[model samples]
Target: SGTAVLTPREPGGLPHGLRAAIALRAAAAVQDEELMAHYRARLEACPGGVSFATFAVPGTMPEDTRLAAILRHADLLTVEPRGATRDDIEGLKAADVTEPDIVRLAELCAFLAYQARLLMGLRLLRNA
Candidate 1:
């Protein structure tokens, strides 16, 4: 069973840098300090990877169209999923994002949300 497919911890289908960026961005969107630190450290350790400023600060990142699409897609999926529509998807496609890659992005976004909720539940359940 050494498939090494996509997992919350493993950057299987996507590049490790993008995976780390998305994970860190998701954690930042949700204000999950623990996860933020975890992914930030991982990303920073990546050779020639984008820094936090690229993702966190507005209008500071370089001309990274791919990362822009991924970040915007992750934001919509994480922050306002109900508001997401085909247009949102078309936007990614317009930015040259592949369908399979989009699916992987969705998987990553969904998993982050799931992990955050599970962590919150555990914290609450522990306190109860």
Candidate 2:
């Protein structure tokens, strides 16, 4: 039997790498200790590398504290207005994501890819 490959339904949305990174991070946040241990064990058994972290519960903590914790763990942080338009990009350009920040983002992307590959391998092994 052969598995069928599905084509994308849309274009110019979030990248696959970014989506995978988001999913991996969310999975790490599962609160069950048994599940967490299972993930850890599977990750260790897998050939590729993957990393996991438990994100702090939101709203239960102060906004600044939550932001700080995420910043400490995140490789790249994206910020967009709740409702933004083209003109908003200009306004945001001056205030948000400066040149040095972009450079840092590139590095973050690379690191995230490495982590995703490791994690994906582990997840697959677990499913197997």
Q: Which candidate leads the pack in lDDT?
A: 1
| Clashing residue pairs for model 1 | none
Window of ten residues with lowest summed lDDT in model 2 = 1-10
Per-residue lDDT of model 1, residues 9-84, tens digit only: 4553367566667677777888888878977777788654464436743223447786687777788888887888
Candidate 2 per-residue lDDT, tens place, 13-74, comes to 22223223333443344333443454455444433323222222212222443223333223
lDDT of each: 0.71, 0.35
lDDT score, candidate 2: 0.35
RMSD of 1: 3.8
lDDT of 2 at 124: 87
Against the true structure, what is each candidate's TM-score? Answer: 0.78, 0.29
Which lDDT value does model 1 have at 63? 70
